[model samples]
Target: MARVDAAWYVTAGWALDLFQGRQTRDHDDIEIAVPAHGFPDVRRALSEFELYAIEDGLAHPLTPETLAISHQTWVREPATGLWRLDVLREPWDGNTWIFRRDSRIRLPRTRVIAYTEDGIPYAHPEIALLYKAKAVREKDEDDFAAVLPLLGPSRRNWLAKALTLVHPDHRWLEALRAGSTDTAAR
Candidate 1:
């Protein structure tokens, strides 16, 4: 966690929800991602809330000592102990975003994030779908189905290329290449 400030964009299923202008599915927790070096700024900005580091599926106090190793952090609502935020510290270069699992996959930050009409930033649905391709849970597949035809050809091509780099034999490649892209939906 560094002191520098950076943008934190909504990610995963919730990001798809934001893009669709509604909550499309029930999510275990909402997630956001910031450049890894900018996490301390997030901690300082959200200091009023309690934060914890997840270790082996357990929540531990998020302190300076744990910051280096904690790629993900949970913001817990004090009174209810209910977690409300999941923060992912992602690797980023000047104007470029790199996939943490495979640095070979990179994109301009502009293409990685898109904003809603109300100005909330979110990960592109195709990028979210790419992440989900790693482990296609029932919910992930549902999100894919919901967002597939909404993608433009460029978005579909980008995601298909990314999947090839990370998970060459990923099952979703077939569907992404199925020519379902609809420019009107984008």
Candidate 2:
């Protein structure tokens, strides 16, 4: 089996694993995200696994830094076209750290969760979603839909705070509050 990163489980992936439970069905491809400087380390660490890089850059760019160092992973899929393995990156400088996430966060360690097509370790489900949300694209929205219900109250709060910074004008926030209203029934 391939090695995997087990530490980075975000609420989304955790929710997917909880709600979907060990996917019996085959997935197109798995996705993961890591800080940019860490990408080379991850790539070097996973050298034994089948590695293919995507030039088109399908995943959402996490930041301007992510754009500067755009990357995507491609694993061969016999029927579903090329499956994407994306890694989202954000710049880190302890002096000017302006990220909006809560302080209790931890960067996950690399571990073996599942193997890739060529037997490289893929990232865990929760880690995948955490990274996926960083991109915040249409597909990521679909991902949120599939996994949002799985998030617990605390994680949801974290997600809300994070997105509030990322998308200050986000309509979903209003919709969410409306959904919570008892008066919506009237």
Candidate 3:
């Protein structure tokens, strides 16, 4: 794989593991988020692999038009047909990380992301949880359960406010508001 110097952060289910400082479960594919504006750099870096824009349950070779419309892309090795990466193009305003659901809700990229001791960047657990909130699947639920207890007041408060804006009536709001650290009941 080729390496590129760009702002990329581990996201989704894998993000929870990064925040927890360990591997919590097996991951089928690694997920990374890049600013929509920097997608060209990513494409150049992964030029050896096949990149497909995933739209409405279909995979299409990425073209300028497809790149403009699709938010998610999957990278695979053509020979083996093995999916290697899941890339999420995220909205950004210079250095701010704009919430995909609500552009009005944004934070400085530095504040919304965390890095490991070795300098690997990952989305903050709260931000990852916010994305997971949209689809409360079994894995999402498990991820939420694992990360909730690790959140402190500031993180919890931030997530609560974000949820209020994006999903006012979300069930997780109550738990976050209550500052519940109980993961067992989840």
Provide the lDDT at 181 for model 3. 49
lDDT of 1 by residue, 105-183 (tens): 8889998899999878899998788888887787887788788888888888899999998889877777788865322
Model 2 ranges with Cα > 4 A deviation: 1-15, 18-27, 48-68, 71-84, 89-142, 175-186
Residue lDDT tens for model 2, 73-106: 4333445545435343333333221232433343
User: Model 2, residue 17: displacement in angstroms?
Assistant: 4.0
Q: What is the Å distance of residue 62 in model 2 from its true position?
A: 20
| Shift of residue 29 alpha carbon in model 3, Å | 1.7
At residue 130, candidate 3 shows an lDDT of 94
User: Which 10-residue span in candidate 2 carries the lowest summed lDDT?
Assistant: 1-10
TM-score of 1: 0.90
The estimated TM-scores of all candidates read 0.90, 0.47, 0.94
* Poorly placed runs, candidate 1 (over 4 Å): 1-5, 181-186
Identify the superior model by TM-score, candidate 1 or candidate 2.
1
Order of the predicted models by TM-score, top scorer first: 3, 1, 2
